[model samples]
Target chain A: MKPILEIQDLSVEVESKKVLHHVNLSIQKGEVHALMGRNGSGKTSLSYTLMGHPKYRVTSGRILLDGEDLAGMSPSDRAKRRLFLAFQNPVAVPGVTIASFLRTSIRSVRGDEVPAKEVRKLIREELAGLGISETFMSRFVNDGLSGGEKKRLETLQLRLLQPKVAILDETDSGLDVDALKAVTSRIESLRSPDRSFLLITHYQRMLEAIRPDVVHILMDGTIVKTGDASLAKEIDEQGFQSIHEASAQL
Target chain B: MSPYSTTTRSTRKNRIESLPIPSRKDENYRFTSLSNFNLQQLNPSIAHPPKTVEPAPEGFQLAACTYPGGLAIALESSSHEGLHLSPFEDAPEAIFQKHRAAFDLPQALDADLFANLSAGRCENELLIHVTEGKKITQPLFLRNFFPSTDQAFYSRTLIILEANAELELAQEFVWDGIESLIQPFACGLTQIVLGPGATLRFSTVQNWNPNTEHFSRTYSVLQEGSQLTLNEVHLGGLKNQTRHLTHFEGRNSQSLHTVTALAQNSQQMDFWIDAVHQGVGSRSDVEVRSIAQDKGQIVFNGKIRIEPTAPQTAAYQKNPCLILSEGAVIRTLPKLEIQTDDVQCAHGASISSVDEDQLYYLASRGIPENTARTMLIEAFKAPGLRGVSNPFTKSWLSKNLALTEEEQ
Candidate 1:
């Protein structure tokens, strides 16, 4: 089956330094793929490059979404095609409240201006599912939010947006057990047959909550190992050193 | 008894002549200049002549009131028993002239030039008086429209809140003339005098047409246990400057000064607020926000003065500016002058561009760059309108002052 997202021989550079070198990976439709790596292993660089971040230059490689190359496409254009990235640390916009921001995002994504009345109803439902009170919907986007609140807000976006290919960039960090449970449950509820997900994390705890169909060990800007869910379990037990060392000898 | 009931032409000429042209070199004019524009282009208007309008706009019955400028425009209802509404000229000359006393508070308190101009030339006046111990449930609405772009008119507005009285006032100024044909100028004074234990909410919306230039002075004095709220939204003009002076004359008086300005496409705006704490145990809070996009320029200067005798005073000020484009400029300065150690005072100012992280976050959510910029700018400036208590006026401002999609 054709993959929904294909990163074929992809390499990315930031500020003239090569951070992702000839990295190649792909996610089939409806599959949750976990990318595990140590710190500075270029996990975030890959996510940003895939979303067409300007600073993350594509030195050499082809990134295709449903067989269409995304090179030179702006982030918004990429998003309109139903691609979404939940940042590791979301930015706080004090004056643009949650309801308004989400309404704007929905309009840009759906190419239709939703009425303010309807937008409020739509957001209230999402806020409830995340255990957030109605007042949260009126707050400036992430303004004065705790770290845990920011993560839940991002997860709420992931569920509300319903992107075709969603990238979760360390959305688990800073989340306590309850928040972690809430975020993973949201991810679980959002999984579907046509949707694909890229879970970028160094922790197996996230995978324990929402198991990935496939796991790839990323080291030094390349996918050094690809295996079934067992590989993630093995990394959890033995750590990434054994995997990277074994991949080096391979 | 009515010495101030009328301003003499010779006196006006002397006042205008007494002051030298203001320049950036002056401390008060640090962010604005009169030398940059041609005073020769100024087109003067006759004494507040009555204007005739065939039909009213916005269902507020505006046309009838905007004639000959904003003078003699009938407020819909002064039927509320304690509310005393009279034309500035028809008010008791003694009281009218009495209120005009110390009209140059800005000049005395802030060393301003515009206050002196309005004091020197004002001919048309309207007074809204709230009688002592009376409460007005209905807010009084005043509208000023300069239908001609080629006008240089002088006008004044005075509001007197008697002791223990309550009042709500909303005033709007709409410039409806062509800039190229007639470059109009309007200099005016708005004074509010609050008696002991009185409260007043003053809301102003200034959207002078881009071709028009507006310069004005505001003087507000508060007595014992009184409270004052000033909410102003300014958007318009080729260039505009507004200076305000608020003095707490009695202990326990409180004042909230809120202002917002939006300028785009070569427009220039200056908002200066100065508050003097002369009464012990008085409090003053000042908040200002401005947005300048596409070569527009914005200036905000907010200062709080605590006199030696004003012990137990609290003064706080915050000014935040958002610049939307490369050429756009914002100069914000929050100052404090504490004469004695018996008071607590603080001031801060910041000018910032859009944050990249926020932009990327919005973009990744499918918002186009231009739309994202508009959303962020609106959010950045929304705090300026937070203190507006009137729903009708607040929503009107939120809708009209909002930049259309293309303007972004």
Candidate 2:
């Protein structure tokens, strides 16, 4: 009955440029909320701000995860609290293998050292679920991986971590049809009564595969419209110009 | 300023017979001023051998032992069959004598009062030989203990490896609690002849006390198809200077040299490394990393020279220094002299503080600023330490790094 994540009057600024202006959003448990916006529409900024990126300053607002204030909490602390963000552009950390990084992340979040064999098993299962090869575990994290491979790796982390709230920013943007289907199926499998997701994307193609309970149209750093799944289809047919006109009339 | 009135000329004729004249303006001694140390004036007292042999420290084991004037020594002792143990004694007519004469012996010698005393007292010299087609499972650990402050110490080691020999040697220099000034000199000459395929890993951990001024000179000659790796970790010193030179004479030889220095307080450290590639298809890599805090000062000059005859050679040198305090000073000069056009040679030197972005990233993860800084330092130094082949040496380096972090 309670909202899984609540952002009240969230405004984010990066280096004197206002990216997100007074954006209010909430997603209830078991609900797939799609945040639709054009390029530079502040959708990714909202996701990063919620995840506590140091570069994104919250000028005024509060972020609540399961009713607990996460306004000033660190990204690692937030991660420990089961908050995960699938970065749109994942940074490559040299000399840190994917296996070791995943093991460290899991141990830091779980507060217990898992055996190497168990860690390898979990990584294998997660990678297999995402259709990633075993060789991916030995490579450096996000190093020399293609865009589609990086996205799948993000999904691999999402599956392995199983965070309470996942903010996946355009994870299906560059994915092929098969990859899109696999990624969508992975997201669909993670849908649970106690879990929530904030999927930020510009394409309605992803929504057709993994249906959303609610769809919101955002323009110029603010959310303009909120409606049901039919709204996504309506926008797919009419485009965002008609929605802008309709919102202006209101 | 008469020609014969110079210090070297007068000393050569009156005090000592035929002292080699060393030019002070040499590039090797450019940054370091030897005038202040005054090595020639302080005549150290001779050291007597210890009454009883002391047990080695923890994490260290003795490989082979030889009594005084013994014919049937270990195979490793054969390399130094004709090496003179003392500089004051008449030089032998062996390969080691020729190698010693090639350098300015008197200037390189540590004749300080304490060094002479320790050299006279420490009679146990080690000779390590790596036979052809032989691989040592454990690292040969040599512990040189300076328990007395009344005498200076001088130790010499001769290491040789035949073709296809692989070995790891770790030497630790420790000076117990002493207030008197001590100068310990260590000179090591290693000849590695690689028959088709051979590998050698050498690591040194110098933990001299604040009162000791340590000087070490190491020269290694690699033959055809050989590989040599050297690692130096300097954790403690008052005034320390080390010179390491590697000459690649045979084709297809390779060398990787890494030096890590962590200095605090008023300690001064200077390191000079020169790698000469004389053989075609040879490769050389040099990396020097240092961390200076308090008022410590460190100077590192690394040079990689490729001869005209040595075509198709590859050489890379990098020296990076991290200054933790405003008072700390670090001077790094990474030089490359390539005579041949068909060579891949590059050098880089970076002197920087901690990265602010990485700090913020770690802090946002709930790690405190100090803890984050430590993590970043560990990450920066971990690359060089991970390349260590010996697990015990790697662990030892990790322990030293932790100690440095705590001191900071």
Candidate 3:
């Protein structure tokens, strides 16, 4: 089957400095792919480029979602196409409440006004499943939230949005053990034939919870190796240095 | 008949004639100039009675209504106990003698020409009084109607709350017609006095025509254990200048002043606020929030003073402003003159544009760029507008906030 999302030789630049050079990747339907890299391996750069962040310039190649070129589309447009990015660090909006923000986003994405009561009920249910307090509905978005709470909120959005392709950029970094279990369980439950996920992380703990169909090792803005889940175990036993030495020999 | 005697009126007119016209060179008028106002339009006359009127909000009684030419009429001798309104010319002799100073205008014409101009041209006024220990259940509402004319209007108001009394009051300006060919100028003074252990919540909203000019002054005095809350919203006018002064006279008194304004087009708004702590253990809080678009300009000068005799006082001032357009300007000066070592005083001011990262975050959530910008601006204004004391006024502000389009 054709891939659900495709990145073709995407060379990205930020502030006129080349960040990602000639990168290519793809995720088929229902498959979870793990992209592992060391620090400064351009994992975030790839995620931002896919999401069409204004700062990340696409110097070459194109990102296609469902065979549609996302070249000149805005982030909002990409979001309408069921593309989601779980930010590693969410920005704080001081006076915008979480409930209002969620309602607005749902309405915007669907291009219609969902009934307030129905939206409220959906939000309450998702929040309860995530173990977040109801009082968080009134608090400002991400303001004064602990790192764990921020991740949980992001997971709640992921469930509500139910995007076709989700880029989880280091979502496991700040979560505690219990929260990690809960988040991974939700991600596992969300797995289906129509959904795809690109789980980006630096470690193998998250990979252990939800096994990936394939794993790719990213080094210096390029993917060096693509193998089954065993590649992650190999990297965990040795380090990226061993992989770098092996790739250099090729 | 006018409340002021002839001799007093003549002296005020003489002062208005003798004082030099304010120029931009003056420090107080540095950012503002009188060139936008037509000084020759000062013929104060009585307003023609309106053919119809808008009813007051539920749970509120119309205390008084003023027309374009400074004519104030008592609207309702309310059935609510302890509520009263009297024309300034017809106040009871004893009550008049007791609180006469609260209605007088400024003596320093050189420092306050506009106030003196209002005082010199004043025709009629209103006095709102609550008797001692009377807790008014219903809020008293005051309405001012501005007629479509080229003439300038002036008015005076005095409010007195006896010891242990409680009152809630609101005032709003209403334009008489849908449109006007000429812009009318408005000048008015309002003074409030709270007796020992008294409480008062006063709200005022000014949404005038964009071409109109307005000058307003409010001076309040708080006695022992008294509490005063003042909420003001300004969303209109061409060249608007307002002054607010609060005197914390008696021990343990408290006051809160909140102001929110929106300036669009070429509108210019100047606000001066002062809080003087004179009694021991008094507390005061002053907050101002404003948004400017197009070439709109806003100036806020806030001062807090703690006297040596007033030990252990707590005073705070905060002013936050947003400039939506590159040409828009916000100039704020927060001053603290603290004489006592035991007092706690703090002030802060911030000016910024819409945050880019915040916008991107919202946009990523599927909200359109325009919708995200409006949402952020609304959130920035929520905390300030939430301080509005009157429900009707609050509703009006909310409705107009959306309708007031950004001037291109």
DockQ of 3: 0.55
| Model 3: CA > 4 A from native | A111-116, A244-250, B1-11, B28-30, B36-38, B57-59, B70-75, B106-110, B388-394, B403-408
CAPRI class assigned to model 1: medium
Could you arrange the candidates by lDDT from highest to lowest? 3, 1, 2
lDDT of 3 by residue, B1-408 (tens): 345546445667777777777676664622456774556766775666556767766656677778766554555545666766776776767677787666566442235777677666776677788889999867777888777754567877888898999988878876765677777788888878899999998877787777778888787889999999887788878878898888899999998888888888999998988899999999998888889999999989889999998999999998899999999989898889999889999999999999988887887778888989988998877765445556655655555555222111
List, for all models, the DockQ compared with the true complex: 0.62, 0.23, 0.55
- The prediction achieving the highest TM-score against the true structure is 3
lDDT of 1 at A234: 90
The estimated TM-scores of all candidates read: 0.91, 0.79, 0.93
DockQ ranking of the models? 1, 3, 2
DockQ of 2: 0.23
For model 2, residues B1-408, the per-residue Cα lDDT tens digits are 212123322332243322222334544442333455544533433553334444533454454322221111222432333211222222233433433433222333333222222233323334455556777765556655555443345454556566787777666666555566445433232233344467878777788766566666676677788988878788765777777777787888988888888878987788888888999999988888888889888888788899987898998888888898999999887778888889999888889888665554444333456755776676567656635856577766667656232210
lDDT of 1 by residue, B362-406 (tens): 999999988888788877766656666765556655665583221
Question: Candidate 2 regions off by >4 Å?
Answer: A112-121, A133-135, A230-250, B1-36, B40-61, B64-126, B131-138, B148-151, B177-198, B210-212, B264-268, B292-299, B320-331, B350-375, B386-408
Cα lDDT tens digits, model 3, A1-250, are 7889999998999999888988889999899999999989999889888888899999999889999999999888888898888888999998888888888888888655457557778888888888888989888889999998888888888888878999888989888899999888888788999999999998899999989999999888888999999999998889799999988898
Candidate with better TM-score, 2 vs 3? 3
